[model samples]
Target: MSRIGKRPVDLPSGVEAKVSGQTVEVKGPKGTRSFTATDDVTLTVDDGKVSVTPRGSSKRAKQQWGMSRTQIANLVTGVSAGFKKELEINGVGYRAQMQGNTLKLNLGYSHEVNFDVPQGVTVTCPKQTEIVVEGADQQLVGQVAANIREWRKPEPYKGKGIKYKDEYIFRKEGKKK
Candidate 1:
């Protein structure tokens, strides 16, 4: 039995969920999101709750059972409360700023890196060293934050670069002279 799949996802007061075939769609104040589960799982919405169950006892079915349940839960949360990711720039001259729909990043390079914000996700610079990514879709928000951090990953030597706010860098000792 799958622990995550055993629990039904409850729809908040303002959130609504619908099921069609293997697909589940959720709508709330933030936005609307949908997910399609594999044939290994069955999805159903009942009385402001979503449930997932495996179609068989195979290993693949059990795997899909948990994953499908989680995906459906994410859809509900995405539409209701949304998702957010934060990035921190940790270098002397490294900074980020929002220019219209573009994010301008100065990561010690000769030229500035211009990252075009996607349609669904929103990127904001609360401070020069801070970047916040927000969107209704959890995957999109995380992807956008990762793309920004990829420009300059934190180094073990000086720990300088873009990184998640909760991330910790493992520092390496310097070579002896």
Candidate 2:
């Protein structure tokens, strides 16, 4: 038995959850998110809560059972409270700006990088160096932040590049003369 799978997911007020066959959909004040469970896992929603049960006690079944439950729970919480990712630019010439529904970044490259903001997701910059990404789906918000960070990952030698807020990058000393 999986401990996480055995736990029931509590639906917050104003959030609705529906399970149909292999797919589960959760709608909240922020937005709606849906996910399909694995074939070995079954999902049921009732009485303001959700549950996940495995078809058998096999190892894979146990793993899937826990994973499916966690995923569903994340979906519910994401739609209710939403998700956010913060990034900081740590170089002299590095900066970012929002143009229309796109983000324009200058990461010491010859040409600027432009990324389109997907629907249901919002990006904001309180300061030039700080960027925040918000969305109702945890997976999507995280993936978008990762893609932006990949454009200019922090370097070890100078520790200058884009990185998540509160992230630490080890710095290397310059070569001896």
Candidate 3:
């Protein structure tokens, strides 16, 4: 039995969900997001809640059961409260700023790197060393933050790089004679 699949996703006030065939669409104040589930599971919405159930007692069906449920839950949360990701710069010369729709990053490189912001997502640099990504889609927000961090990953030698706000960098011993 799938524990998570059994729990229905409750819709909050001011949020609306519409399930059609294998697709579910959720609309809220932030935005509208939709997901298409596989044929292994069935989706049903009732009483301002959404539920997922497997059609057969099989491995694939059970797997889809939980995954579909979580996907629906994410849609609900995404449309309602939205999502956000924060990044912090740790290097001395590393910094970031917003220029119109583009993000300019200086990560100890010979030249400044320009990052073009994607649609449906908002990137803000409240401080030169801080980056905040916000959007209705959780995956997009997270992916944007990761891409920014990839330019300068935190190293063990000096830990001079970009990283998540709550991330921890393990310090390593320096070379000595």
User: Per-residue lDDT of 1-177 in model 1, one digit per residue for the tens?
Assistant: 999999999999999998999888888999888888999999888888899999989999999999999988888888888899999999999999999999999999999999999999999999999999999999889999999999999999999999999999999998998
Tens-digit per-residue lDDT, 76-147, candidate 3: 888888899999998888899999999999999999999999998999999999999999888899998899
Give the Å error, residue 120, model 2: 3.0
For candidate 3, the lDDT comes to 0.93
Angstrom error of the Cα, residue 144, model 2: value is 1.0
Point to the candidate with the largest lDDT.
Answer: 1
Local accuracy of candidate 2 as per-residue lDDT tens digits, 59-118: 898999999999999998898999999999999989999989999999998999999988
Runs of candidate 1 exceeding 4 Å displacement: none
TM-score of 3: 0.97
- Please list the residue runs of candidate 3 whose C-alpha ends up more than 4 Å from where it truly belongs after superposition: none
Each prediction's Cα lDDT score?
A: 0.93, 0.92, 0.93
Model 1 TM-score on a 0 to 1 scale: 0.96
lDDT of 2: 0.92
Deviation from native of the Cα of residue 42 in model 1, angstroms: 1.8
Report the error of model 3 at residue 162, Å: 0.5
lDDT of 1: 0.93
